[model samples]
Target: MSGIVDLTLTYTNDVAGFSKEASKVLDVDGWNASTLTFYSHCGTHMDAPIHFNVSNQTIDEIPVSNFVGKAWVIDARHVGSKGLIKPEHIHQDIKDKFVAGDGLIFWTGWSKYVNTPKYRDELPRISEALALWCIDKKVKMIGVEPPSVADVNNLDEVTKIHQILLKGVVIIEGLTNIDALQTNCVELIALPLKIESGDGAPARVIAIEKYL
Candidate 1:
């Protein structure tokens, strides 16, 4: 039998200050509907090359296959708040499981701070060397439990890491529930909304696992 795990954060007004307005109500319009006001990159989202690359390629232009692939979850919980995630953190065991075109997710146990003031301030960042390692491995996509791959306060570093990773892979950020994954290896399916010429878009990400 196979089971699915949802790896997305619930889009809420309290989280990231995304707003929602009731457009139609059951008592007045005989239906219930609301208009969402949030940034395209808010919540769990995917970053297209255009997000950091100069070219015109956007989220809608990326192939669907890039968002779905075999994923390996590397345990990075040891990384402390505001610490750097270095290449050595991966170790040989995790590196052995890496295959070209595989999607990689780092479980840093950082999702616990979501919706808090310290969430952005205390994000653990990926080192440039680690980013290069991923590039060398030809990873298809990279996901993290943090809001970004780099320190949010450091604009220069953020741009550098995004540019490096986006050169050959998609990046998924603001992911949650990664710690709930029962296995290290699973099928990752993270599809973003198709928005024309969009730099990035929020996504509904999940993992599918088969049990013996």
Candidate 2:
């Protein structure tokens, strides 16, 4: 198997509420350094329960082990713009194969449109049933290629879905490389920045095939 597949996005000025500036430069400031400013939820990130008031726990409070686990990338490429990813969209093979405590990666191939408005404004959202399904099945984590798991434009939809999922699941968004996986099963390792009381923070997520 190939060593690993990086599933996170590179933060840049193009992303909303994200900025970078040279705080110091070699030869001029005797050191080379830069300052990064971004929203807690910007780019590839993980959401804590407190993000939706599901609990008082922050991203830092979540056990790091919860972010690392066996994962299965369910095919969601057919779930297009403004579409809903229903439970039926998740095939029976994946449902039967992945037991509790395994991460589920929804491969919507949305990352290809990152620079386009459709990436955010018209994302394929996870339906309420699907959110509950993950919780009912006791999934360890659910990663998605979209910036959000629900319609950001719909307050009720986004909040409800997040609240339900955040109650028990680790959510990783803005993933990019799931499409490159040669197999549906993978070992997911996602690590978030340890920001104190952070609602969410950018993460570096990767997939390994050797485990399977």
Q: How many residue-pair clashes does candidate 2 contain?
A: 0
lDDT tens readout by residue for model 1, 1-212? 77789999998888784788899999999999999987877888989888876467899999998988988888889898898888888868868878899978889988889888677888998889989998999989899988899987888999999999988888999889987778888888999999999999999999887521
TM-score per candidate? 0.96, 0.97
Query: What digit string (tens of lDDT, one per residue) describes model 2 on residues 37-150?
Result: 989888899999999999999999999889889998889888788999988988899888879999889998899998688888999989999999999999999998888999
lDDT of each: 0.87, 0.91
Clash-forming residue pairs, model 2: none
Stretches of candidate 1 exceeding 4 Å from the true structure: none
